[model samples]
Target: MSDKAKIAVDAMGGDHAPQMVIEGLAAARVLYPGVRFVIFGDENVLRPMLASFPELDAASDLVHTDEVVTSDCKPSQALRRSRQSSMGLALQAVKDGEADVAVSAGNTGALMALAKFILRTMPGIERPALVAPVPTLRGESVMLDLGANVECDTRNLVEFAVMGAAYARTVLGLSRPTVALLNVGVEELKGKETLREAADILKQASHIPMEFVGFTEGDAIGAGAVDVVVADGFTGNIALKTAEGTARFMGELLRRAFGSSLLAKIGYLFARRGLRQLREHLDPNNHNGGVFLGLNGLVVKSHGGASAEGFKTAVITAIDMVEADLIRLISADLPDVPGHEEEAGAA
Candidate 1:
């Protein structure tokens, strides 16, 4: 444990919980041998899984807990029960300085709610935003506020830009990322007052001189002209799901076309490898994970539909983020945010 990057994982937090998590962690261990994990969940069930793979004990340490935080449980209930819940325990490990990062695929709402309460937002943060990488025409692009805070104000949007820019710079290795406001249109008079206000703020904000390239429509996201797209969680979530559905739809349609006749089959035979690569490039399953930013500590969220591969991906993301010291970089760029600043004379 002392020899690796420690990450606290909720063993029973996903849809397939112990089964998928253990499998994914096992596979990931091959690629990331130096990464250590702290598993938190019902020892009774998880212990048997660990026994099935003798290698499990060698890979991770189990922070045993009996209670499980279900997807339907209220945030408050989960937090109250967290004293003994797996997700709670995993998170507590990070708060206690025992782990460098935390990962979970449990109830996103509850997870975000509890994270805000327990970890608290950064000094300049108004609300924590969900940030994820999306497939793009050029390569990949980053987007933010993907359902963490469904409702947001202008100030919150500005903070999202600051954080997103920082993440793009530090994690994505963009020197000065081209930031864009996810809006209905590109013209200056396109969106509502809310977007207008947010756009204006990004234009003048010096926290990070992100290339604030104005608005971007749904179609433009795939073009990849922008590095980060900032929007309210409600809008961002809708766009994300819509993009996933469209990618799947296109794949099926192409497959159906290629399977039509002997002539079509021959063409597909030669193009099969490229087609598969294209499908993989666009598959949401490949990147079905994200991080909740703006908090003092690192917290990542995995898709509920995630397999072991997806869970492993989330863990890998959290490890890189913690190692890069991303939050500290963002803090260096923000204004005197409400929660970020220290009290003057102890208030």
Candidate 2:
């Protein structure tokens, strides 16, 4: 038990709902005993899974419901019409203060739509960003606006930089982490006018503790020079999916190459340990999930296709967010939004 984070988890949310989701929750419960769960689904269905694990000695850790929200439903409509759905009910727990965080692997569109509607944005945040912790050559990186906001202005980009910097600092323990705008070219002139304008703004901003490292290319995302990469959801999501697809493609090729013959298999046997380590390192499901930044609280979303292991890690990540009090820190880190600080103060 680690202080009763009290997370609302959607048992019937993902592609493998209520099955792998149950398994992940059970696994997560063992590692973090203090995490009491509010399982949003049918009582008859959820109780069996909870009782199946004899390892869970305490009855106080779970709360089951009879409602479920599917991945096929529209996010906004699901929230509005299905008030009793697991997704909606679970979010209601957070809104009502019964739960500290919410985790879902269901319909991402609905998740975001419901989250924005139910939880609402923080004081100054116009919109929320989907931020994922990506592995870099050094360790990890923060990629922002994963799929939340696509079209952005200079201020929105600057805000993403600030939020991303705060996440890197508080989560990754990077002091004065580097911030970069994802651009086609490393030079300031390489991007659209918005990038140039954002560069001018960030160039003089003082609220953000990160060193505004200017622009970064896809190649440099893994180079480890920058801690935060800022872009709109369309670009950021494309990059994220690209990296994941490439990693999976490479793994398949290697498996075919190594699994073909006895000698190759033998060589792979000798090389098994190293290959396994590499696989673990590059696994998208390892750090594949991300936080919905600019919210007043921590909200983590995992892949709809996430396996049990991936969901388990997502739970761990959510636990870490609760323990770290990431939301409070992010709110506290910036006295004002960068590039807008001077104007706001003057007013």
Candidate 3:
């Protein structure tokens, strides 16, 4: 890869389509002047849009492909047409060494399936986990297996810890990120046998670039109890969705509370600055990238309904991963784990 990061974009993947993708690329170009884009979408739609931003157009290469992976498409169905779809081609760019990373606001299931099939998992990794950064009281923290594998084994959870730690180190700039397994309780005796087993392994793996803090309950996640939270997909997904919903609920409550009476509305004026800051902190667009960790190459998933600003954040994330050499960091950390050697040998 060159000094300039080349991002492969699935322009047709999101709800806003080529327009959002193009606008985002333009904005990202202003922020990351060295980064280039390889966009895959309908030429008729994209070319005219790109023409609007001369700098982004200069820094981008357009690949014509009208075929798109619909939001409702199954992974199995998407895979059959992978070669022709915009999302598939973007991932293919990463797999073929044409781009440093791939970003899409497409179908999560299809993206995961196509990424795993095209890029495959790293040597000691059994599966790729969806990892994303979450806002917490301590600023920010990372979490993994958001919805990738519904049920994970001991080894799988362990792998997620390693990958999540590496991601925190790379993206969050934490040299030795603190990690925890998300469970019903913080006690060693709590949760599934797999969680306990994974905890034990992490405790013993001093070679990994993380401080294993045992277990953390779901409530502590937003408290910034740990830098990296590892959980089975089923639990992590629920935790993520719940957190998002809670943020929205809080915003709505505040809005209603302020508008309830003249006194409340008058008080809102005095608290507007602080409230604005809080809103910015909780905005999902600021944390839009959901990375597919444990893959041979980097692939980021943006929210389907993400705005141009959100899409720009996702592109920035891919560039950060490229600059941090995220793949090498994860690959280097994997081999030292207890069962990884045996697993790799078996494979």
Candidate 4:
């Protein structure tokens, strides 16, 4: 066993797997030359696919299993019946110390359920928050509860903030990350009681290792108003999808406008470089992984429809998290919370 980071992959998890999984790993191998992989899936399907990429074959070890968690599988169903499935096995590898992290492009609910069950929660975290980096004008910012908890209490929001700030410090290299709660408006009295109460607590909290910027409006997420944006899953999910849709809509409009006339085509040629930069900056594939924060081991959820390049980005993300010692950092930060001792002991 190599001492370096080893990622466990649910080889049959994605929409285009196992091909996309193998191809993505092959691409990732080029970027993370020293990293190793342990692929979990049917040997018959994965072996043939693995042969196509010699580099991946050289860097990987295959574990055969015929079971798979379908995209429509319910979390409860998966937990009760599919414990040996590809997604389940990948997380199991993490628990068994066979891999440093697990990556799956599987059912989000199923993945989250299995990971939480297998890895368990960190001492002070009530629930794991789904977090990812969002592209913004100032730069990328970390946002959490992407779809993990549809409803959150004040404590959950505070914990999410702590986790997000730690993530920002690790990935964005920020020393003291600024955190903000997403609200209807930026004022103290403009939002619901849940949001306001959370804001009040954050504002009053001390020695938490983050600057709690009062509140941020929806429009400010892409403006990069804060390093970490915290919201309940219901609101966060809508915001995430809306932002994705808007990015695609804008790209489509640009394409149509640029192709409408000869003059526009000429303009497009002149603007191609800048447009390419914009495309790269906004590409969902570049930020394809949603990490399950609060799990004992790292688990990155890749988009179900992600392409090979997208999956590679997820792999690289897992590598970065491992190098950052994200779990340890979160543990260290959790102690500063006022009610953390009671909550942690209860869990």
Candidate 5:
């Protein structure tokens, strides 16, 4: 209830729960000394793990819960039966004002379903969109609808634009970020009707604090042509996976090239420093959090297979969202919708 951040954690979720979760919480405590945590999971398991990290234990309160939402459980199934589960209880803490944000590494679908059902969408926001930062040539760009809604209309895209831009400003420190719709080409005549319509609306909107950079092609995403990229969940998810694969492919090729011969090995020794820097820059662990934007309360989804470092990145990302007061910024900037003005104001 205080201004200081209180993170609700689903300690039972993820590939390596309890241990990994505790390690990440320890790391986050070092980075954010004032942050507190409410851990939800089986007391027997988490207590032993907590003993290993006394610092984190001193900063956290453990809540007992044996039920867990499995990685493969259907979203509806989780919604129906996971009320007392670790993941569900963590979200409930946020809904009950016991936590500022909820962080989980559970099933993506179940997390989305449960979070939406618990927190609901903010006024004027139809559905919550998943967003994250992707490394780009210029720096990093914010991309939205990573895998939330497979299909989206113009209104959805416009809403994504607003939310993504606000997120960029809050997390990335951009004052007036540039936003563009993802399309086949930069031409105004290219791509689907939804992209065109969203572009048209964003370009004309006067309330939002963003520059409509028109349209950007998929190739421009890594080039950092804009601060925000708007796409339907299907396309965005595909692009995200493809980019991840390409990065890995390039890394493997580099390794093979360096291991091919004695001369290459010598070259690697000389270039190893630069390569290490590049590897760290491209490591997914440093960018492991994806946010569910437009929810009444914040919920961050960490990669299920994330390492302690990766989970630490997620916790930091959640703290950043709280520090930025993301919900207030979104509520203030969301474009006015017909008949929803009063609701939005109240939000």
Candidate 6:
């Protein structure tokens, strides 16, 4: 890796396509002058767009590929066309050491599949988990397995805890981030056997740089009860979507309430500033990057429908992970677990 972080971008993957990708990279260039970008997409289209942003053009290298992985493309289809597709080639850039990280506003399933096939998993890690930082009342907290693996065993959950804790340390800048299992109840014996077993293992592993606070309920995630929340993909995905929906619902209700009558409109004038701040806090673009943890190299997934600013946030996130040396941190921490040696050998 050079002093400047090299980010491989899948320019043709998002709903807004090459335009949004280029716009976002241009914006990111202003914020991170040291970083460079390797953009993979149609040269004919990107070349013309690059003419508009000289700073980004000077900082980026364009790799042309007409092939693209569509929004509806399945994981199986993407694997077959990995070499030619924009998403696959960007990931290949990371695997080949041409780039420190890869960022894509692409198909989630296809991105995960191509990344696992190309970069492979870290030692002692069976599968990679999708993690993201969520805004909480207390501050920012990290959550894992957003939708990567639908089902996970005790070992997988334990690995997520380890990975999530490392993410908190790097992204949240916490020396010893508190971790908890997402469960139906906070009690030790409340959830499935896998949850209990995972908690028991974390409790005993004192060497890891995290404090295990046992189980946490679904509602506690927004309250920021712990620094890292670990759950299987099915549960974590549902919780995340529900929270997003609730935020939207509240925003709409506020808009309707403030417009209901003359007096309501008068009251809205007094609360407009606070409401604007609240809207910014709840904006999906503010928290757009979803990291694929446990991969040999760094890969970040920007939302497919993300705006230019949202995609810029994802690019910055990839740079942060590279500068923080997240992969090395997780690799170093995994061996400290009690039974990770045996697991690595078996894998």
Ordered list by lDDT, greatest first:
6, 3, 4, 5, 1, 2
TM-score of every candidate relative to the true structure: 0.92, 0.92, 0.97, 0.96, 0.96, 0.97
**Residue range 127-225, candidate 2, lDDT tens digits:** 889998887788888999888887988878887888888788866887898999999999867989998888888887755578998899999887676
Candidate 4 lDDT tens digits, 25-45: 999888778889999999998
Model 1 per-residue lDDT tens digits across residues 44-163: 888888887667567789877778888799877876766567887777788888888889999988888778877888775769999999999878889998998888888888789888
In order, what lDDT does every prediction score?
0.82, 0.80, 0.92, 0.91, 0.90, 0.93
lDDT of 6 by residue, 35-151 (tens): 899999999999999999998899889999999999999999999976678899999999999999999999999999999999999988989999999989987899999999999
Q: Candidate 1: lDDT over CA atoms? A: 0.82
Candidate 3 TM-score over all chains jointly: 0.97
Cα lDDT tens digits for candidate 5, 1-347: 12379999999899988688889989988878889999999999899888988888988999999999998999999999998999999999999999999999999999999999999998889889999999888868889989999999988998898899899998779898999888899999999998998887777776677788889888989998899998999999999999989999999999999999999999999999999988887888887899999998999999899999999999999999998989989887874433345666775
Flag the better candidate by TM-score, 3 or 4.
3
Best by lDDT: 6
Task: List RMSD in Å for every model shown.
Answer: 2.6, 2.4, 1.4, 1.7, 1.8, 1.4
Compared with the true structure, the alpha-carbon lDDT of candidate 6 equals 0.93
Q: Which candidate do you rate higher for TM-score, 2 or 3?
A: 3
- Which residue runs does candidate 3 get wrong by more than 4 Å? 1-3, 342-347
Candidate 4 similarity to native, TM-score: 0.96
In candidate 5, clashing pairs total 0
Q: Give model 4's clash tally.
A: 0
Worst 10 residues of 2 by lDDT: 338-347
In candidate 1, stretches whose alpha carbon ends up further than 4 angstroms from where it belongs are: 1-3, 52-56, 207-209, 336-347
